[model samples]
Target: MNFLYEKITFIFDPLHHFWEHEKLSRKISIMLVLFFVLSLLAIEAKRLGILTGPLFSFVPTNHFYAISAAFTVVLILEVISLVFTLPCSFSRSVGKQFEILSLILLRNAFKELSKFPEPLTFHGNQEAVLRILSDGFGALLVFGLLGCYYLVQTKAAEKAMRPTDLYAFVAAKKGIALTLLGIFIYMGLHSLTATLAGREHTDFLHQFYTVLILTDILLVLISQCFQPSFYAVFRNSGFALSTLIIRIALAAPPYYNVLLGLAAAIFAILLTLTSSRLFGKK
Candidate 1:
């Protein structure tokens, strides 16, 4: 019975500890590969104007639809994640904390996504902003749970792990938190900016966008005192950068664009450093 109990804990430990034993370069490289492939599809869709929905493929339409579809897809994935994660989270032998916790997490997330301010006004947007926020809310909750899981995993490790490996567990939990937080900010910002611009945003929209993003990034960098994981999380993914590129390629602006690009680059680099360090790479 004791042996069975220990084995169950190992499954969770291994997931968190894998980050420590696994090499940094390899993990990032793999993540990047997945990033690149997904990015390529996104870029290609934009280039070919296929992102606006295949049924509307023949007609040249708008960007809002594309954003909506993408955001919807992301939300669906989180919902699916909840289905798998709930059992792992709350269903305790007697108490079932994971299952209960998971339900609360999912509910809060959905509420954020679907529920907007009262006197709900669509500033000419179809529904993308609300969709993104609702799904985003759930994702954040799940991420919070992930942090909890990591911490629990750490305690589990203490039971069977070397004394020295304890710090490794802490590091991994912190790393995951920082990394996920950054992603949350980046995507949330992206959705907000685009929503503000709407479909009929005039010329110099990118310039305004560049300023907003740069300011946000700079603020985060300064606030965090340049923490590596903090920087790495927000700054890690180049998707937002890609979105900016697509806009610029559509003739947004290049000179001022570079200024904004600099901010994004700094954000990605710093956050990656933070995450890598937290993963025990430091």
Candidate 2:
């Protein structure tokens, strides 16, 4: 375990180190943006038959699908940012996760547009219409819930944390973030290689949430060191439960999946708001 921990630290330490340096961080961000743009152009060219390669066939031809795919990449970056924020404020991190999930739903809604028939009438594509409606509604609802969470969080009382404890918490969270980064790299490469090799590629969101669930569990365990009250524990656990619900939604049928995801967000927000009111009043 010690060896594994050291290896993870070695791999992820550079990310934390670079993030501390403003110039280096900005350069990395610009590089990522350039890469994303180049990827989109390459995929577009492949679709247009201007480029010939084994990967061309896998590239999404529809403009809507291509745009949605790009947004999914952005969502992944947002989740990475959330992971980095976990050590500082758990509530804020949870809020960021909610935002990412909502964006994922929005991306799905965009993807649904690609499924619509060319004429795009309501009669022939009822199923697609339902999917679009469900996804769009779910995205809007989650965004509203996120706004409420932010408000509740701002009004909530701050926990008194010792400087030493804060340092320890940040260090532990950084290690976990590095481990998560490693897992993400492995999963992404595995999925891409499998797809290119003609094997079944794993569902990206499903695999990601599975890893996220484990990370959330680790975070909850880490939170135990701060001697939080019962409500705080409950709230954190609720966030984990919310993530699980979203993961389960990924496997459900179209409309049902959106409904389930929205319900989870609603439940989480209500729980947090109630807890804040009760605990903050004391």
Give the number of the best model, judged by TM-score.
2
**Which digits, one per residue and each the tens of the lDDT, describe model 2 over residues 1-282?**
456555655665677666657897678678667866776787678767898776566665555666676677777777667666665666777777788778888888888877765456688778787787888888898888788778777777766679766656666777888767778777877888887777776677668878888888888878876747776677678878887787787778787877887887787777777777777665
In lDDT terms, which candidate is top?
A: 2
TM-score, model 2 to reference: 0.81
Q: Per-residue alpha-carbon lDDT of model 1 for 77-157, expressed as tens digits?
A: 332232222112111110122222234333333433333433455674346454445434544543454344344433331
Model 1 residue 182 CA deviation in Å = 32
Off by over 4 Å in 2: 1-49, 53-55, 117-123
RMSD of each: 18.8, 3.8
Instruction: Give the clash count for model 2.
Output: 0
